[model samples]
Target: MPFSVPPYRLSQAIRDKCKRLHVFVQAFTLPSCWYPHRIRILAPHPVRNKCGNAVRIKTPKTGSAVPTLADVARHANVSTATVSRCLNSPDQVVGETRKRVLKAVQDLGYAPNFSARALAAKRTKTIGAVIPTMDNSIFARGIQAFQEELGRHGFTLLIASSAYREDLEEEQIRTLAARGADALLLIGYHRNRAVYDMLTARNLPVLVAWAYHADAPQMSIGFDNVTAMAGLARLAIGKGHRRLGFISAPGATNDRARDRVAGVRRAMREAGLRDTDLSLVETQYGIETGEAAFREIMTSATPPTVVLCGNDVLAVGALRAAKEMGLRVPQDVSITGFDDIELAMLAEPPLTTVHVPHREMGRRAAGMLVQILTGQGRPDNVELKTDIRIRQTLGPPPPER
Candidate 1:
């Protein structure tokens, strides 16, 4: 039996066409040494005559084709374990043997699995901090010092800012803890109960800073806001400033501001003046807010001779406003502030403010937290001193006019 072509199909014509196509393809066929299945259909190859023969070719042997660690051990005259130790813990092997195995590894470019080493060590050597806000230089400066101190001890610091929201701060704290932070640093004593509970439940060491109260529930490392502010108020009164105005943070929930206002009232009472003689304006902590608060006091029937600000930031605003109003600072209007930030000295008349030891506080806080983490001691209350930086902004009243 023989194959037959249908109508309109010629057997001789089909056979001739197939023979021509085979020649066209054979001209571009890969070398016999090349893996035919691995080559793309459209891949280019050396051209050849119709003779069926392999082309002389060479290809680089990549990792998938080459011998691995086991082969390296066999070639090095050592066990696989000895080969791995030479690649990793070289000090554990004899010097001469280590050199031989290392030479074999170098020749083969064998890389040990780093994941295995990391799993064995089980330490990231990192610390975590959550602060109220980085926008304010207070936290930024303090956190910078904290990180520098941590770096000195060969530890890395991871920081997150909550922008003064308690909920966000707590969530960030949890996130850092979950990511394997050995210790945590927080700002201020006031946080949600659940945050404290979370840390307690995890047995995590936590340190609070910024504002300090002797009997706070958590460990704290800071200063007495009331005593520091009150001392300044008493000093201002002693300098013959009978009419005093206080520019402070809204006392609604800020204990530090509330205590500062209390200090001013206490000083006024001690000077045989009615508490009414002291006018207090609660405002946000900003230069603009300080200016507005100062203006409000100035427009009063009994304008104050001395104005005390919650912090140096507000004092600057008050000073700028006084200058704009054609008033001479410390002469027409004496001003004092807390937290002698760098901006205090940069003012036209340097600010007479309390110098909060920001860097020292941060360093001390880190130390206390480290102590707690290492079981050296439990959390304790710490109160660092706040000294007065007497500059040109504070002076006696203008002849009691």
Candidate 2:
């Protein structure tokens, strides 16, 4: 009988390797030149296979056929079933037999098929993430922590960037799920209605990060955006910054940005300043945009004594604008930022910003997802503390003002 093949694409691990090799993949059958299975052709040149399904193609440089499970079974003088059990569930096989099968596996350089194992266990041990963007370092440290935690639990992570676009994010989410993600880690909770419904229907474990909404019915792991930034606002206000301005990434799709702005407004309102007294400039997330928005807010009939940025990326830009405009930070004007990323410290005058516990959040988020996946715990949210990092960028308003 002809060899049967499962449907759909190669696993993320295989595709990642293929990307580094710059190999082109196509649906084709194994040729007489190689094995008798259907596989994707990752050929520098080109070859064909009559097999109906797809597998990653990494032909040996020596032009030898890739080793298969049967090869290991033969080398160990055992049945394929024994080799399979030794690889997948060693406790089910005798110790001596397991050792023999493993040694054979090592000698033959055999890798148990990922798809086959996933099918048998109904778990891929793979986690997926769809982040807003990868261009900046804001999410880098946290994501690194998340990957490290997942690695410790013997899971692989695959990430896709959405560039802050909701439609693209939804697409990436579906693609990740279709590609065998056991659970997903997503940013704040402003997703489409159908998204949660779909994940629920599929019985996938999904966690929202970067914002904690305990009252909202979503599993999240992060600090409360409103309360965290409110603390910073109060600190800035306490320093005598009566004239305040806000430079933010677009709040249309981001509840985080909106919440931060709301926090500042709340502080001002409580301090007896009308919300209209505050200047709000919404821009894309970039250094250039930050500089331009800062200029616009500063050149007003009466400039703000301090400017609050939605996050560190914009704060970095505002700092640049301050220097270029011949204004000394915290002297001529105070500047505050959120998400105390690495750039916050690197600012000429180190930024006095809100310090988010990114690594801890990532680790906790991973632990929660793993618990849900492995049946050790149910879906839940974890609230982390956000600290006010007092540094050079925040001070009382100008002596004259």
Candidate 3:
């Protein structure tokens, strides 16, 4: 036999320095180079630099090698069966043997092969998430909570962003599904039909978030978009704001935006204000867009006394625009926003917006997914509550108005 060391030999506790060094080189050949300090590599089969003289080249081990169970058993002076028990069911092994075996394995640079374990167990305990965008703090906060909860259940999370694009979101879904994700999480219900079909065909357990509807085709774990936004609009209306300027995201493609716009319209309708009485400006959801939309809304024949933004990002820009235009917030023009993000409170006047329970929703979503994955239970639509955060940002119409 070619002087080849067994895979398990490297994992044995090598008291002999020569044997340890020999096992190190034989175990790892060329691929394992991640932790350079852990192992040394020497030029194997070194030949003489000059004429016919034969010289032996030391083979250096540069990384941790694959250490089998037998290697650990021999190193620890225990039977292979005992080593197996220590790894598979440690409670059956005595304390002294377990400790010695573990220490020996550590000294011999031994690590369990997770891939083989995964194959045997038939489970990866991983969840995947596909969001429209991570640029928004709302998504980021929710995902952080989601991952935290998953960690408690001994599961890992893989996340990807799609930049609010339907096609890219679909692609992420396919990629995650192919990566052996036990469960999947998505931002919203709106997506390509093909993607939905693929998920259904593969029988992947998917949870949709952000906006929830009872009749939605997919499972959801989110608040009712129409109701949440409606509550905010109602709060704005209760403040005696009759003339309104709505700075909303373009509703043509985004169902969430459409629902928010609908909520605003419903509030205006209840107040006996016709559609003509409200000035609506559709723009991208950004600070720059907010500023431009606010300026445009103010240019109306009869400028509205209050401006309601789609979200906090736009509200911040709107507030800046008001100051630039010599208008004091609440006194010159009342401003209201949605999604009470961190920036909402930091604005000149703390934002009067709807506080979304992002963390709670994320936790519940993760918990539900874990339950489903473990065959514990399935979750119904998780409707998280939202509250209207009344702040100094919104007040009665200006005295000038």
Candidate 4:
């Protein structure tokens, strides 16, 4: 009797040898009992033993072997420094040399390691933006414009959503900062002082957007929310809407919502109407929530003649709820919304709302951030303007009924 290698161990041994030699066993079989055996060897080719079944082997993969700067330089027959200059400062290199270097980069599928570059350059050339939500189109247009402008300046945008939670926004701010964002774009100046202190400690340039206050401590780029909403409220009041109803987002957490509510009160005071003349409801921002809030306001003992909403989403919801309640818009009860989003225009009867320059605000915000990052003097706070879009929804109270 002779000792024999176990089938599993023998197979593993063959596999190990095959990997080292870059070849594989095509087909093989082991003896059923303990016996001495011999395996025929093949170099650089598939090896088969007794069985017809081929034991297939795969060639080793080189996919993880990333092409580096030196690889690009060698492929282009240039120095690594020349390759770096070509990528970072292409204008400094001659046209022909630049073309050759770029071609080699394309051919070798070489991508510069941005992590190393950011480490050496001490700037990631990236901006982080945190908004309240992404579930609606309210911030969509502005963010798109912001990203486009940043791309033109060779910087990338990293966006995160806080879902309207201040705690989450603070976490996102720290996370973005830790990940090396060169600058930041925050929605409002309502966050905790600790967050601002952290940004200051890190020396990160920040620009506040979506709400503008002349006396805000931080640099900001946005319209005056209070004034804009006040202008809209005045128009509604001028139309003789003495008995007013307002559907709004929670004012405590959001400066924009709070300021808009202040604007309505300002208009009410200007018109000599007591605060009791206006009915108010605060809810989350959504079409359904708007509908529910509208129904609640209208079912009161003294219902308003005109319902003013915080934004277009809530206004559209109110428009639907009003129709359900058999109330004719402007004739029976009027409705007005803020933010002039696309839904405002597409409402059953186009919404009477305030038109904000969302795209312009976004672009200018990016420009201001870039200016600060590039060591240009910090730009002054910008105040964009808003207009009132009077559509079919707003009108005088119904015949004093």
Candidate 5:
């Protein structure tokens, strides 16, 4: 739960309270009895939360308590409704009166119940995202960017990982919707038709990310995966690395992985390489799985001159396996990856990979969803770009050993 509450939220809450306090002090003078030094804000007491709807404000320094809106009103020398207005809609209150109400709030440490405030608002100001996995750094930076932008707009972000399982994602989606999420963010457009239909039927807007297509249904905010990967494959081919091996995540559910593999195949075909020439292995999305697959490929009678991974995570695994086998990267066998995650840069050879604008994509996705919800824009797809960052991990095929 502590991890769920980011520092930005706490800072924002305090800053808002402080602004209100400054206004209250300027609006009018408070009697010495209501001075900040003598007053202390108390946590809500059960009696105040129960029958008769009493409010509780304890001043530990003075050994006294003032409970209820009536107490705040009396302390501020204003009507009860005025006290409410100052707390709820200070902008509508006369400056001096608003300041007076804020002073009372600060002096007594009067904080309203969260559930009561939500009921009055009629909307929860929360957005939910169901990503594939949260344990890795692949989505961490991007999700953090999205959350910070959402915070700027006074909205909370709730995240749940489906662990690459659609059934779990569907369940989480329903739960978040039931909990009153105004919008949803999904990964890729490969989900079941029924899931799409459900959101359509309920009129809930969803924006898909991490992969994009021109014609397929949902709105997208990501780069063209096939094209991005194809570019890198062509470059590898141009470097004269004829033999190739592909390490990928399961293609059954991952459009991104499928696209990358397709891109490599297309490149190989264009170079007159037969289908059987390139060894392809689909593995789980983990470093250890990647290492195993890498080792498996390397042991073949005619090992590949290069290995192309579906993502940086897999490439890093391949690199590790290469190291353990006493193989030199780019010299003994070249390797490349996609996603350009932070781990890519930290790799020993500094991975030569495709750099997707993850943070930029995240910020844009949140903005577009907000625009659609506010009726300012339609759910249109926005495609971003990717760059091929050639680095130490890739090079021309080595001379025969």
Candidate 6:
């Protein structure tokens, strides 16, 4: 009896079998009661069984028709093992044979299965990086440089953003590990102890970037946030701005933010300023948040002479707010920011900020991870320097108010 099934419903195996048998299968609606809708198998010459029902054919299962390493080997007239070596370790194969295999690969559009290759080599040659946020350009340049460096070393980078949430960051780290990341680059040293334990159990090499401490247990390649911010704060104080207002991101889960606040406080204490002199407003990192924080600080009974922002994003926000409030920068109230990102210079009055070597940090971070992974040597914690860029936005307090 004929069976009714759509042409597309037929598996590839059946199609290949029909192609080999020189038969074509088509679906058609039949008026016969025995077969209302049936697939008609047509051959060069019609042949029927005793009951006149089309004979059912069976074909052995086979792999997908997509080109494989074996197909490339066959086309290049080389052994499968030789094809594998040519694709993976090209230097292992002779120049002439390598050229031939590569040609076959291109002609057949053959793509090696990376999953299978990774399984065989016991390495993925892939690195995963988890950052605090991707909403801003703060980490953009650094990550781009890191990726370029990784590419130069014949590795790939996979990035995930945690939106500054510790729990989500932990989840992404575990997911990356489960996905067989050969290594990982984390933003900071602060995380659940279980995260470190899991990495140790997996024997994964982990590198911490963005913030650094000499006594940290994990390998770190970054600047000291406290020292960098302290240097900037001291510069503002030296300019004769006694009253300082700081707008910072929440420091509860952010070591960088916490250190920056500490740095400001240290600078104020050294400058003989009272605790009441500095007014701090903690908020998320964004232009609008910075603007709102600045407005809040300015409305206080005794607002600061200068507003020190956690990063350029917040600083830019403060600048925008100052403009709308008819406040002249450095005249009405001075403002400063960290992370001399491009926005700092582009501000109405170029921002006076701390210039972090973002690209160098990223490139060096990648090199450090590669070194540890390849067993070249374990690197020491690197403390890069941050310089203060004095622009138009920061100066002496406005003529004693």
Select the stronger candidate by TM-score from 3 and 4.
4
Cα error, candidate 4, residue 334 (Å): 1.0
Higher lDDT: candidate 1 or 6? 6
lDDT (Cα, tens digit) per residue for candidate 2, span 1-401: 12133322556565455444332333333432343133334322233333523334444455777899899999999999888777655667898998999999898899867898799989998999999999767578789999988876767899999999999999999999999899999999998999999999999889999998889788889888989888888888898888899998899999999998889888888898888779999999998999999999999998899999999888889999999999998889999889888889888899999999888888888889888888887865688898999899999999763
- List where candidate 4 sits over 4 angstroms from the true fold: 1-65, 68-106
Instruction: Give each model's whole-structure lDDT.
Output: 0.78, 0.84, 0.80, 0.86, 0.82, 0.86
Clashing residue pairs in candidate 4 (N, C-alpha, C atoms within 3 angstroms): 26-54, 26-55
Off by over 4 Å in 1: 1-124
Counted clashes in each candidate structure:
0, 6, 9, 2, 2, 0
Report the alpha-carbon TM-score of model 4 versus the true structure: 0.78
lDDT, model 4: 0.86
Task: Write model 4 residue lDDT over 1-401, tens digit each, in one string.
Answer: 21164334456656556434332223232333221122223222444434534334344355768899999999989999999888765677898899999999999899888888898989998999999999767689899999888776767899999988999999999999999999999998898999999999999989999989888879999989889989988998898889899999998889899989999999999999999998999999999999999999999999999999999999999999999999999799999998888888899899999999999989989899989988898999999999998899998889864
Which runs in model 2 stand beyond 4 Å of their true positions?
1-107
In angstroms, give how far residue 343 of model 3 lies from its true place. Answer: 0.9
Tens digit per residue, CA lDDT, model 5, 30-103:
33324342112211122222244543333236455646688778889999999876765456689998888878
The lowest-lDDT stretch of 10 consecutive residues in candidate 5 is 38-47
Clashing pairs in 5: 24-99, 55-68
Clash count in backbone of candidate 2: 6
For each candidate, give its TM-score against the true structure.
0.68, 0.76, 0.75, 0.78, 0.74, 0.79
For candidate 4, the per-residue lDDT at 191 reads 88
lDDT of 6 by residue, 1-401 (tens): 33266545667676555444433231232223231122234222242334555544334345668898889999999999999787655667899999999999999999988888898989898999999999777699999999988876767899999999999999999999999999999998889999999999999999999988989989888899999999988988998988899999999999999999999999989999888898999999999999999999999999899999999999999999999999999899999999988899899899999999999999999999888877798888898888999899988888753
